[model samples]
Target: MNTSKRLEQALKKLYTAFHHNKLNPECCKQCAVGNILDNTDNWKYLSDSHGALELNYIGKVHQALGRKFNGYTPLELLKIERVFLNACNYKLPLHYKNEKPKNPTDKDVLFNGLNEVVKFLCYLDNISNVMDYTKLFEFENDKPKYKLVFTN
Candidate 1:
């Protein structure tokens, strides 16, 4: 599969963050978009609030100028954050009264968030979801449709 340079880089960063235990839903610098943007929290300024799809004044300027951070526009970063937060069961716009996971750092919770973020990223690049494995379960005429092979 030929993935775009941006998608490849973003996926690598996300994978590293996930393995390093740096992926966090509540922290702007450790969230999905943050990791993709080199673990910087500056992307947070693109929006007035966390998980908001609307861009603030600064964000609008960047969007209008076609400025991209790590190959993603300011609005794209906000959308990525929103998708991540939503998949992690975080209430939008992150507030005190919003519903959130009791253990936000749990592996399962983070994995769920990463799964959706990856899907969204792939969607943006018009590619297949890298994390999808359901095709391995496909069967034809009571026979396994896809073979799992290990190469050394």
Candidate 2:
């Protein structure tokens, strides 16, 4: 299969996993993508402390990638955003009938945020096989948070 098709399939799997709540909440804290979703200290600045599944969240991902990866460029971020927006059906506040509606339910917010995070992680995995995100998730309280381990 082509790279784009592979990415779409992987993102669909990630979205399904998130819809099932298969990820540890704390994982979002350790991952660049998750940090963007949860508005963690590492990326909250990009969204003014607001965490949403909006396309704008990609900005945080772009910034994080630039800061962490020496040669990463905006072109890569643009591609990632294009894929993400497509997966989300281009959902944005502007698409809503009203200019501003009530806050989304907590479940909806979590679903959207986690879905975006999962998609971003999948994108990174596709681009570089160096990230081991499975090891980045922590579920048990007794276990320490997993550190990001980049192979190269």
lDDT of each: 0.93, 0.41
- Candidate 2 backbone collisions, by pair: none
Q: Stretches of candidate 1 above 4 Å error?
A: 141-143, 147-152
TM-score of each: 0.93, 0.28
lDDT, candidate 2, equals 0.41
lDDT of 1 by residue, 59-137 (tens): 9999999999989999889989999999999988998799999999899999999999999999999999989999889
Model 2 Cα shift for residue 62 (angstroms): 11
- For residues 23-142, write the lDDT of model 2, one tens digit per residue: 323233322233223323434234432224332555566765664322223333334333333333334322345232143323454455445645564556565332235645665787
Location of the lowest summed lDDT over 10 successive residues in candidate 1: 142-151
Candidate 2, residue 27: how far the Cα is off, in Å? 17
Top lDDT: which candidate number?
1
Using TM-score as the measure, which candidate wins?
Answer: 1
